[model samples]
Target: MASQVPPQIFSRRRRIAGLRRARVRQAKRDAARYILDDMVEDVLDRLEFIRMSPTRVLVIGDWTGTLALSLRGGGSDVTEHDVATLDEEHPVESESYDLIVSLCSLDRVNDLPGALLHLRNALAEGGMMIASFLGAGSLVNLRRAMLAAEPDRPAARMHPLVDNQAASALMQRALFKRQVVDSRTLTASFGSLDRLVSDLRDQGLGSALANPPPALDKAAKARAGAAFLDTASDQGRVLEIFEILTLTGWKN
Candidate 1:
C-alpha cells in the first residue's frame, strides 16, 4: 500500500546536517539539552531492565548518533538510520534485527501504522522495539501561549501530537506481541518564551507540519511572550510541559 503521509512533511533534504548543527549548537551552549539525551538514556535504562543483549540492533532517528555509539560501545552491531534515510515504504528483511530503538522520530511519519508494521516485520522473534516521541499534552504552555498570541484567529504553530491510547492500538494493529504504551511528563522552566523556543530548535524539535502556519507577526510574538510570562511561577520562570510517550513491544 502507498503511504498516506506526504514525503514533504519531514523534508529530509539536509535533515542530517541540520540535526548535526543543532547538536553542535547545543553542546557549545550551556542551555538545557537534556531532553534528547534524557530520552536516549531512558531507552538505555529500559534495555538494561530487560537485560537485553542483542547481537544485531537498529537505531532509528538517531540524529545525534549517540544511541548507535552507545550500543556499539556495548559490543553490539548497530546500524543507524535517520529521517534523511528512511521513509514509510522502506523495505526490511524479516527477522533482521534482534532489537530496535527509535528516538524522537516516529511521531513525524506520515504513515505511522505502516511504519510500525514495517518495524515489526524487521524484528527477530522475541526481539524488542522501543520507541519514544512527543505525544499529546506536550507543549501545553507553548500551545496556550500560541493561542493567546493569535486570539482573533489561531493558526497551526505546532504539529499535532499522537495520543497514547492511539499509539498503543497501533502496536496491536502492527501485530507486536506483548505491547505496552506509557507516558511521562517532563517540565522545563524557562526564563523567557524565546529561550524555550531556542531550546526546541537546538534539539531539532521544530514544527514539521505539512502545511505549517505562517510565521507570527512581531506583535503576535510579543503577545505570546507576554502570555507565557503571565503563567510564570513565583520563581519568575515559565513552565513548559513535554509529555514523552514511550512505546514498547516484542515480536514473539
Candidate 2:
C-alpha cells in the first residue's frame, strides 16, 4: 500500500524565507515573541508537572534559543532545529528522541496529519511529543480587517488552522497513546494594524501559501487599516486574540 501525500497548500520555501527575514529583523529591532514565548512556557510547565526528564530531546522553532538553553541546563542532550525548513516527510530520526518539542510550526505545515505521524515515528516507544501552534480562533482582528478590505471578494490572507477537535483526531490516527489535546487563549493589544502585522512577521507568522494573493491596492490598504482601527476599544487599542492549541501524546 502506498501512502498518500498531503495537499500542497503551504510552501515551505515561503515560510523559510519569512524565518530568514525574521532573524535579520529581530537583530535590528526588539520584536514581539509572545507566541513562541507562550509555547515555551507551556512546554516547560508541562514537563515540570509531568516530572519527566528526557535525556534525548529535540527542540524545534526555538528562535530565541532560550528553550534549548534551559533544557540543556537540565543536563539533557538537546538537538535544536529551526522549524522553517523541517520536511514533514522526514521530520526527525526514527525512534531516537525520547522527547520532541515543536513550537509555532505545525500550523504552517502542508501535510499536518503526515507531520503528526512523522513526529510519532521519531519518538521511542512511550516517548512523548509536545507541540503548540496557532489554532483556528487566532487572529480575529486581522481576519476581520482582511474581510473588510475586500467586501466583494476576499483574498487568501492566511492559512487554515486546525482546532482542538481536529488535533485530537490527528493524534488518534497517528496511533499515539495517552493523547491529549488542549487550547489556550492569549490576548495582545496593538495600537494599529500595521504594528500587529509587524509583530506577526517578527515571530515568523507570515503567510506560507503556495500562491499568495497579490498585495492589496492603495484603496484596499486604507480600507483595511480603517476597518482594523474601527474595532479598537476605549483604551485606544485593538485586542487581538490568539488561540494556541497544544498537543501531547506518547508513542505506543
Top candidate by TM-score = 2
TM-score, one value per model: 0.91, 0.96
- Whole-model Cα lDDT of every candidate shown, in order: 0.82, 0.87
lDDT of 1 by residue, 5-35 (tens): 5455554444455566676777765755667
Best by lDDT: 2
Collision pairs in model 2: none
> Candidate 1: deviation at residue 22, Å?
1.7
Model 1 spans > 4 angstroms off: 1-21, 93-95
Instruction: List residue ranges in candidate 2 displaced over 4 A.
Output: 1-3
Candidate 2 local distance difference test against the native = 0.87
Candidate 1 accuracy as TM-score: 0.91
| lDDT tens digits, residue span 1-252, model 2 | 998777788888888898998888887657888788888988989999999889999887888888888889998899888755467556575568999998888888877877888988898878999989999999988999999999999998888999988999999998889999999999999999899999999989988899999999999998999999897889889999999999999986
